[model samples]
Target chain A: MDNLSMQKLLWGVFWITSLAIGMVVAGRLWHMRLLADVSVRSRVQQSLQLVAKREGWLISDMSIRSVTPDAVIIEHRQHMRGRDPRVCVRIPLGTLEILPCTS
Target chain B: MLLRVLVFGLLQGFAVLLAELHRYLGVHTDEAKYLLNIPYPHPPLMRWILETTDGWQHQEIFWRIVFASLLTQGTWFVWDMGRKLHKDQRVTLCGLWLFSGALLLQAGTLFMPTITAIETLFLCWILQRIEFLKRWSALIPLLWLEMLFVAYQGILFAPLIFVALRQSGIAPWQRWSAFLIPIGLLALYTPTNPLTIVATGSVSGMSMGMPLEESVARVLKLWVIGGSMALSVLGLYGMVKSKQYPLVLTLMLVTAYIFVGFRSFYAILFTPLLIAGLLSAPKLLKSSAFLLALQIAAGTAIFLYVPFPEYSSARSVGDALRVAGVHGDILIAGSFGHEWQYLMPGPVKRYRPDFTNDAAAIVCLDRCVAIDRQAWQRFPQTTEEVWVKIRD
Candidate 1:
């Protein structure tokens, strides 16, 4: 075979391999995005509740105020400190964990 | 023609949207540096461009738009060059798709050297097409702009321009004069040795310490990360089959340049050339549409789902430092010192252990800071602590 034919064959193989890779990547990304959406809110709320409980506050008093792509803002009223004040905690989504609901 | 315009416009819009997403996530270090107008290692043109839109409100968004525009324009130029090189509209669109899909878009999301490198390539392509006599007049300003924007990497482009001139059938004197103009300007304006910048690996922190096997692996890893592994292999085969030796040589040189430096972001510099080579190969013509669609799909998926971590902690640290009444020369000690130096308002000093006493406050990475609760108070409302020195 001539050099040109060989080159053509190599490119043909590369394109097939690229298509396979692209399909796999695209499929994986789709799965991950689905998982993220399904679990992100519950995961964030559970973590916030755990932190509140650890701080000697009731889980019932704390609630998620807002959730953005990068952060989750939680508003909670602390009654144990003898003064009822609403405290807002902003946790980066990247740092948020999926803690068990111990309460 | 309208279809072409619409398609390109949509691609540009998608590119801009991806850039906007990046900006919203957080201010990257380079973006922060440009925002603060800090003297960076690269040329000042990018900073100056960002400075024009500087204001207190939504400045990051403004900078993102500027960056997006640069990438969009660069993509358009690639498409334009593709059209000039190949008759097939599919090939042109595929080239554009390949560019928009690659890590080049991610690099474009920030104010980095990658955008300027792309712009330099665009200008070189334009210069290559211009008539010799006409190019002489155009060459001087183009070279100056390239130098002013890209610094030492701009000099690597000289051989490409030289090849372009040689192919133009211009007389030896004319070609020499055309080339000499830029060299003269570079000598007059640039103080340091351009070659020294490359030798030192300061361009992209690429140096020559790793083993050859490791270096090749690093390059391959970068190629994969950039989402161009298969395209690059195809492009390489295409370049060889087409016998475009100059381009092949230049691409090899650039790959080596990035390989030695080993900066992943620098992989963007050769993307346009790779795409061009791929588009030019006749054998790949049938696959162009499939490749283009797959790339666009992959690009869109990555843009929507991939989480680009923004260096937002720098801003929080800066704000905390100010609120804590820390003033004067602040010391930043960490891997992210360059970012802290840029974000900090006042005269900032990067940490050296000896100069720790000179700072009013020390912004050390959590791991790097010594465990001393008595002498330092950690600032609240920040992921990273800003340790203000206790005043006696």
Candidate 2:
């Protein structure tokens, strides 16, 4: 084979090998992006529960409906130890509000 | 089936190599030129291909043959990966076709974040189908590595460390250490290449600018700069939270260019990686329709934002000249005055670059040049006015 032709063939082989490996690696990254893990979400939920108790407030309900980078939503009815919740607080996107201890 | 996949695997390597070669050979002109200078993200596998082909010089037949081989191999690699990942031969072929279509729309348009986004989404697909954690374990390191790169690129060190620790499922120290490897490597790499810091900074809305007093101009500046920061942050955050890597990468580009002074079109390079990842696994796509829609909508928004004809067309400059009014025969000069050629069917001549004073183009566009007062007097008959002038 001519020198140039042989060189092209060799380069092709090298290129093929590296990209193949990179693609496999790139593929796994995609996998990580897809699955949702419980580590952080669970911690947040647990903390909320603890706070709810200290305030003498009963969390009427708590659920993980949707989680995006902007905000996390937990739906709960507020109730003091003896009283039912008549008021609800909805936080705006990018805002944080501390719930009342009396709940 | 194994061979089909194996062949495609090889093509993926060449595709990345070729993408890099293209970056080496070409560059974007105008503002993006000085603003950022990063190596194409796919890592220029094609240059390696070209280098290896050195001995094949002087034989046209073989040269053509190798050229054709690379293209065919790249396409097949894409198709095969799709098939294997999807666990369906038909989907693999369709995915390949879809990828080819996207590449045809634009190839070797290598910006790292966009490509990472698409690849991330595709990888997520592969992970879902993998089912067996043991089989997938070998691949997770690469996933971590890319995120490490993203963290460094966007300066998201804290959250990246957080995610790596949370996902590692190991003891606290082990997880923390896993996160540190990337930082260690990143530090070694960044100083060794100070260019990336400057490049990333310019494209991250942290461009170097002189400090100034609080005034109307400063307030306007803050509004512009702050607004860009907010947009970039939002776009990146939205993609990450959605578990859509492609979208995340897309958002990165959106934020970087709009807020950080990079081009949105640069996101094209991610096309191949996206093709490889998404095509690899297809069935899970049904649930991902929202993400797909989001990407398209975002892309459309950018397109609607097309400011004018590109610089090369001269049409954009002609629009600028029209804004200047019938100041007809005088030679108008600016950094990118060649554009005035097409803009001014009237006698809109550009002043010589070196000869023209700094205030030279400020007469046309307010490009903050210290136009010498003497030079301004030279064109006494002419005056400066703010008009909806053309942009590069």
Candidate 3:
């Protein structure tokens, strides 16, 4: 192969490798949940606490179950006089409003 | 008619992206200062330009559009420069496509001096290529003044200007004398002289420089984000193979500067030469175009999905305060005060640790103030935590 053929081969290899990498990166970013990252868990917790404070709801305990683009799913026990009920609630990400448990 | 539609469609796409970015980001500290018209510690030209959008309903959006327009001009000039170098429209277009996907363009949506600096450098390159300086030698002083007033960083391009002058075959005395007028005029204007201010305070005030290992890491990160790894690798190969010593010199200067003080937007300076490198290999144009398209897609995906919350929380904090029915003067504790001051429609006072005030609300950003939990009602967001006074 001459120089032109050699350059063409290199370009082909680059195109394939870059596309593969690009696809993987996009997939990873798409699936990434802000709550799942251990580093940002504190922030998520603080947000949940802020929501609880704002709504004047006393919580026995809370743990993040999953996070969507717009909301975070969490299992929490709202403080009651004699009963603690663990329920999954969906809280909007930035707005931090805890809605009634879906299921 | 087809071409017109194509151009129109591309512009519409660009405008949408600009709007998305404008809505996504909160005003950064640097951008906030410029937005507030605080032109000190840097040249005033950028602030003056931004002042054009004052009183507009959507001033930030208008600012982004203005910057995007300037960067588009810079990108066009780079495409034209590629054409001059390669004499092949296809190769130049491919280079331009690769540049559009580069991290520089992705981050250029913000209001910053990087775009203006890039525009000045691109204009200089195009003028030098076309021998504009040689044709109109009298404009040399004017060009110098423009460079000086635009940004202090413009002094880096002196070597390129010198090269342009040499290529023009102008008399050495004439070329040397042209710089004198601009220098004397700049010295006369003490307040705006970027050099004097930079010399006295910038080094200590900026807290510039880091360990070599960190500096290298930062540059590598910028290289990957500014241009894709493939583009950079190919560009490096071409730079070595083409033996373009002047381009290499500029790269070294820029690298050294980045080592001293690195901002991600400094990546714009490397773009023209990187495109030049892409143009050097004619055989790879088709494959390179495909790779560039992939880069554009991937870059856009990351930019939209990833949440970088720094300096973007001010507007949200302001909105939350407004919703809480807190009005009149508010005290801001901690940094990014300018961003809050600009975002809020009401009077904003910076909170001092010693100062006592009867403000209804105090928003602490990135840093928390010592406040009695009983005295203030706290509303915390992801980044900014607002404390509204409850006690009289």
Candidate 2, residue B166: how far the Cα is off, in Å: 4.6
Model 1 bad stretches (over 4 Å): A1-103, B1-9, B25-40, B48-59, B82-107, B124-141, B167-171, B184-206, B224-227, B297-312, B319-329, B333-335, B350-361, B366-377, B388-392
Question: Would you give the TM-score of chain B in model 1?
Answer: 0.76
Candidate 2 wrong stretches, greater than 4 Å: A1-103, B2-102, B109-122, B129-138, B146-169, B187-192, B204-258, B268-392
How many clashing pairs per prediction, in order?
Answer: 1, 35, 1
- 1 or 2, which is superior by lDDT? 1
Q: Report lDDT (CA) for all predictions.
A: 0.56, 0.37, 0.56
Candidate 2: lDDT of A28? 39
CA deviation > 4 Å runs, candidate 3: A1-103, B1-5, B84-108, B111-113, B124-143, B168-174, B180-209, B277-309, B322-328, B352-360, B366-392
- lDDT digits (tens) for residues B340-391 of candidate 3: 6566645555564433246677767546557767777877552466777785
Ten-residue region with minimum lDDT total, candidate 3 chain B? B187-196
**Models ranked on lDDT:** 3, 1, 2
Give a tens-digit lDDT track for model 2, residues B1-392: 99867856665554555455433333233211111111222122222333243333222223333433344344434443445443444443333323332232223432333334343433433433444323333234344555445434333223422443354344665455445554554454443222344445655444335343323343333222221222222323434555655444543443434334434343332343334334333443443434444444443443344232233423444445445453333334344332232233343323433434221232344343434444453222333332222222
List the candidate numbers ranked by TM-score, top first: 3, 1, 2
Encode model 1's per-residue lDDT on B1-392: one tens digit a residue: 99878866876775667666675566666566565544344554566566555544566666666666665556556555565444555454545434443454464366464664565556545644565324344333344444544444566556666776566555688567556654554443332222223334554454556578888887775554344455666666777888877667767777776676665455566665665566557466555666666666665665465445446577677767767777666666555533554456555544555555666777666454453567667766777756777788
Q: What pairs collide in candidate 3? A: B26-B312
Instruction: Report lDDT (Cα) of residue B383, candidate 2.
Output: 36
